[model samples]
Target: MAKLRTTFVCSNCGYSSPKWSGQCPGCREWNTMNEEVEEKTKVSAVSSVKSKTVFSSVSSVTEISTGDELRYNTGIGELDRVLGGGLVKGSVVLLSGDPGIGKSTLLMQACGTFSRDKTVLYVSGEESAKQLKLRAERLNVNSDKLFVMTETDVESICEYIKVNKPEVVMIDSIQTMNNAEIQSSPGSVTQVRECTNLLLRTGKSLDIPVIIVGHVNKDGAIAGPKVMEHIVDAVLYFEGERNYAYRILRAVKNRYGSTNEIGVFEMGDGGLSEVENPSQALLSERNVNVSGNCISCVMEGSRPILAEVQSLVCTSGYGNSRRMSTGFDFNRLSLILAVLEKRFGYRFSGMDTYLNIVGGLKLDEPAADLPVALALVSGFTDKPVPDDVVAIGEIGLSGEVRSVSRISARISEAARLGFTKCIVPRSCLKQIKTKADIEVIGVRNLHETIANVF
Candidate 1:
């Protein structure tokens, strides 16, 4: 034997220390450090062909590159878009979401894509094969190669993968899989990390794509050690309110492509349906031809979306006015209010101003500023803007209508949503010509926008 070493690792954030402390420095958890054994032994191989593989993108003995030419399709467009176009081979992806929010639905759909064309083994730790079958039947999914195995033992799952040589493997959940090497309970920090590590190695050695779904904590974050995310090649967050019908798949990390992209999906009876154009679904059918409602066009990544903004302003009976905003940035709302007080001198401090973006959509783009302020003005004066009109432009502190990104995309999306008129930055006017029927009003400054809207 060469040597034996022991160390304490924080179960919360994977902070390893020489010894245990009363509190962990990584996640500030109390008494979470657990000791583990490490045995240094000679390398033994049961099967060996070569020490290196081209698919791994390893340049030398120790260091490796991940940008190898490997991208496998998961067979879902929305999932593909959220995953930066496809899955990176030998990468571990963590899929997380709220319970009953279709995390399993999305993963099952992914397996169905490969099950018909390629071999995929779905190791389910929580649901049985029969249970999974029922769900698949309900989804009306047909797959010949998607094998489902109900087991929680990490060792057995590894053996199955080694014997079956699957192209793609999905663990329904990582929390339920526990390694015998670790004595902790399944779903504990130690077991989650070790099981993930084993799967990580299996993915690299077998050149197979492995995806692990995890339950989120109460904080709406990934459960288990934060290092679980660090060890993976990609981290995807399946988000959106369950009460609402829509689900938003967001990518936090990607080694193969850009992470800024997002996938939109809607929850339905059969399964999750990919929303091709989600902007239309987010707008209200009830016409907003009244005060406190304004339309704004914004873009997430390359996709353009139209969002409705509503605001309320009234006289403040107290010493200071109350400014409340939902589905929008608070700071942006404050800036708009300040401009109304400073530049326009509207004296809004003596008023209670409430702002909201309709359809429960959160607006972060500065281009929404124009419509947000307009909605406030509409609410204060109780004047309704044109129902068919929409606006897109960033508002400055000095009331200038700044140009926004992808103006053409925004205009196109708005037009697709049947908006009759578009108010855009004058700077973007030269790049795009308005449609024959729809009118495009170009404004250079906030003064011009206010003058045009009112």
Candidate 2:
């Protein structure tokens, strides 16, 4: 019999220690260390003979074959774009998001497409088979090749996979899975880690792709140890506000594809539908010729998306003016405000400023800086920029507009969306080899931009 031992593990980083402490030494996060039980197996003493072992042959990189078809289409164009063409074989993808964020719905919707030709195993630990069937019916996903199982035991699930090898395996979530060998409760650090490792081994050995759903913590990060993310071939995050119908699927890590790609989807009664033209959808309800509203173009992988930047500026009633930003970085906002005050003579210290990116889409690229600044200036002056104008450039500390990458693509997308004018950095004017129908106006600095827009 194995002896049961207890150890403290960090939920954030999966670091184990013999003693409990207020803070985790590995991750330096406080209150994340939790005690977990582990069993230690004893070695036999009658081991005089060596055990036989099988070794895998190593092949040269040039000798390896590359003609095999290794990707499976999930039947979703937007998803395929984010997955770098399609789902790679033997790849373990971790999909995570907030509850009710359509994580399960997205996978269930894909099962309909996957089960068209290949067999799929949909394992659910959170919902019963009947409940899954009800949801599938609502989603209009009816497929004979799709099989559902309400199971939580990791060993049993892997054994079943071995006996009946399904082309695709979808785990509803990894947190609910438990290993009988691990004494810790399900969703615990040890149990989650062991279960994922077991599933990963099975998927790789059988050349089957495994898609595992994951839950997010309060901080909006994937729940369980951070090592879980490192173990998976791809880590995809479904991002959007619950109140909003728009959802953005982003890949933070992809071994076979670019991580910069994102997929847009709109939630409805029939489940999630792909937003083919995200720019048009995002700007569908945008009010024209409105003060504090500006359009910006950003590149998500090879696709360029146009998003609306909105700003609100008003007199501050308190001692200090408040600065709030949604879907954009706060420090970047502060820097832009400082540049406006120092170089452009915009008095924002005495006024409260708010910034938001419409459509629940976050603007992380520096190219959004130009439109954000423009929106802020428009809000402060109570002047509306032209309705058919889009801005694409990065703002420097000296208030100079800096050139951004993919200037041609950005302008082309804006032009396709019916924008008449594009405000770009003067330095990028030379990079625009393909002449777009929209009038391209290049500005050198904040002074020129304000002179042209207003």
List runs of model 2 lying over 4 Å from the truth: 25-30, 42-54, 219-225
Writing each residue's lDDT as its tens digit, candidate 1 over 100-126 gives 889999888888777878889888998
Tens digit of per-residue lDDT, candidate 2, span 36-115: 88776732211211132223435688987754888999999989988988999999999988889999999999999999
Off by over 4 Å in 1: 1-69, 219-226, 314-322, 433-437
TM-scores for every predicted model? 0.83, 0.94
What pairs collide in candidate 2? Answer: none
Instruction: Point out the worst 10-residue segment of candidate 2 by lDDT.
Output: 44-53
TM-score of 2: 0.94
By how many angstroms RMSD does model 1 differ from the true structure? Answer: 4.8
Q: What does each candidate score in C-alpha RMSD?
A: 4.8, 3.1
Highest-lDDT candidate: 2
